[model samples]
Target: MLVALGQLAAAVVVAVGVAVVSLLAIARVEWPAFPSSSAR
Candidate 1:
């Protein structure tokens, strides 16, 4: 039971980390478009 709990916690942490990284990556990818779009 303890092992399962530990695994669950690890999974949750990994998921959160991945989500944060992906969001940052997506923002980085889209960030350049904003400036040119507003210039139009």
Candidate 2:
């Protein structure tokens, strides 16, 4: 039971980490586009 709980915790941590990383990546990609659009 302890091992299963540990695995679940690890999975949750990994999922959250992935989500954060993806959001940062998307923000970085869009960061430059925002200024160019506004400049027009």
Candidate 3:
């Protein structure tokens, strides 16, 4: 039971980290478009 709980906690942490990284990557990808869109 303890091992299962530990695995779940680790998985959650990893998932959160991946989500944050992907969000940052997406932000960077769309960042250039933001300025050009406003310029138009």
Candidate 4:
């Protein structure tokens, strides 16, 4: 029982970490500079 609970907690932590990282990555790449590059 304890092992299952530990696995569940670990999975939740990993998922949340991945989600936050993905959001940060997208926010980093989605910049106004992209439009400037197109005009060039």
lDDT of 1 by residue, 1-40 (tens): 9999999999999999999999888766776657774456
lDDT tens digits by residue: candidate 2, 1-40: 9999999999999999999999888766776656874457
Output the TM-score of candidate 3. Answer: 0.70
**Model 4, C-alpha of 25: deviation from truth (Å):** 0.1
Residues 1-40, candidate 3: write the lDDT tens digits.
Answer: 9999999999999999999999888766776657875457
The list of candidate 4 runs beyond 4 A from truth reads 31-40
lDDT for residue 15 in candidate 1, whole number 0-100? 100
How many pairs of residues collide in each model? Answer: 0, 0, 0, 0
The TM-scores of all predictions, comma-separated, are 0.71, 0.73, 0.70, 0.73
C-alpha displacement of 40 in model 3, angstroms?
12
Model 1 worst lDDT window (10 residues): 31-40
lDDT of each prediction vs. the true structure? 0.85, 0.85, 0.86, 0.85
Better of 1 and 3 by TM-score: 1
List pairs with backbone clashes in candidate 2: none
